[model samples]
Target: MADPILVFDLDDTLYLERNFALSGYQVVGAWMQARYGVTDFAQRCTKRFETGAYTGIFNHVLRDLGLMDSPDLITRLVELYRNHPPNITLEPDALRFLSLPRYKGKRGLITDGPPRTQANKIAALGIKDQLDFVVRTGEWGAGFSKPHPRAFGYLEQAFQAHPEQMVYVADNAAKDFVTPNARGWGTVQIVRPLGIYKTPPADRAHAPAATITSLDDLTRCLTQF
Candidate 1:
């Protein structure tokens, strides 16, 4: 028997996404304007993330925020993200799954990010050393983004596994699960919203290979898989 691939989404999947208060680029724009008298920060954020380029992101944000666009902007922006910190909370089930002695296959992270920022968050979560691989859409240098099969395909190539053999877990149904399912990967939806609230009316939610309301539900469900 061969090992199946386990491609996990870090933000909304393994960790509770809503906990971090991650809004779109528009929110980042508002934050920058309020902090540094910079208007139109959102357009820069949107372009940087959409194109998978970190250099432009930091430099643009810093310049618009009234900081000099020197080489130090990268360092400054990094410090800001690290020290400011987002709302990061991991599910108990995620900890259990990652801490298990063996997952019976090549396990990896298929997350979307500009790289350094995501790496910082991953390290803060203390899961950096436990995984077999970490695939960042921008870090790969191919200019790709998640929910895109190309990003997922990179892990498939590295693990030498088929999409159907993999189990993908995430919170966004339309962006995370639907695309993977179309590509034949098993999908699990994590529904733990902030304050443990269940949004989007549970009854009408789209069906996944498995549905879990809490981290504790992972063990039992994975056992069946």
Candidate 2:
């Protein structure tokens, strides 16, 4: 069989997304401190994030500091967070996995998020040249994100690959595998220690073809494809 075209999800699959979050929080925090004189804002944001406050985190921090959680304020903070230059690096295991001899020249990346935010991450990781191509779903609109088939379809056309000759490695089960699985692309889930999604998919359709706790097991999992 021909070597499969290996595509990867960018966030937790290639690097710890928490690091990007923390980095963004720092940028937001610093901005808050400079604009509103709120010292330790970044630290407080990190604390809330660590405590599982995934949504409206900035609002919570503002309320905790006795500031008004105004819509305008929250929007600004969010914009700042998403647009800031990110500080991140590839996971050691992911780096090694990409450097493998067999997989060289066959790599691609597909990620979902705001285009600017995802592009910033791609640039910070310095991974553009490492892969054959990248698909930022946001560029196609929110409706085209994972579970939507459009991005995966783009990959299929770009590689001129049959579904059996492609594999998508990602972290999120809820949306990552559904379209790929239905399209007959081999799908593997890489569950990093700090990966956000922990629960298994409730149904087979959303589940990955295989799951690995680390990228080191990626090749072994690929053999099944």
Candidate 3:
């Protein structure tokens, strides 16, 4: 039988977002403000996304911020997001983790975001060839939300494995770990120390299957599995 598959979250899990020039929401907000003269539009743009209606969440942000008064502006903002310089950095130990011999498993990336921007980051990092699957939200006809079953389904099908035959490592405890744990996939929390915004004290209580402080520590953490 083939070894179990390994599913990973793209941003912050595989390649750390050391310092993003602009977060997804920030990018949308900046476009709204600069293109439409609306101030404080970032908050509104983020609010719509948080509410689970992401069908052109950017387009809506533009309309609410007054940039959509012209259709051409909408097209330009879309183009900008696609071509924006990636601000994410590869975690120092990413190559080591990828090189581990014991991890003889099909590898896949399961991330949620605007398809174009996320694809750019994946391509720029040059790891797409290593990935057996690339599951994106808008591009795959799936719901644009994390912790959604559909997202998991796309991954399982791509990797050709059952839920129990995969281990998913991600950074966020709430969005990344908890639901997958509930879904019966092995879950590891990447415990890279975040400067002021540390992992919530609550995640310590909940406890992931393994806690890895760095990408290099991943092999050690998975020894028992």
Index of the highest-TM-score prediction = 2
Worst 10 residues of 2 by lDDT: 98-107
Winner by lDDT: 2
The best-first sequence of candidates by TM-score reads 2, 3, 1
Q: Which structure is stronger by lDDT: 2 or 3?
A: 2
TM-score against native, each model: 0.63, 0.96, 0.67
User: Each candidate: what lDDT?
Assistant: 0.65, 0.90, 0.68
lDDT digits (tens) for residues 5-82 of candidate 1: 666788757775434433334455566678677787666665555454534576766666677867664665455543
Worst ten-residue run, lDDT, model 1? 196-205
- Cα distance off (Å), candidate 2, residue 10: 0.9
For each candidate in turn, give its C-alpha RMSD to the true structure in angstroms: 8.3, 1.1, 6.5
lDDT string for model 3 (8-105, tens) is 88777777553332354567567767855767766775567556564576677666655544577657766775567665666778777776777777
Which portions of model 2 show Cα errors greater than 4 Å? Answer: none
Error of 2 at 37 (Å): 1.6
What is the C-alpha lDDT profile of model 2 across 84-153, one tens digit per residue?
9899999999889877877643878899999999999999998898899899999987588878888889
- Candidate 3: residue 4 Cα off by (Å): 3.5
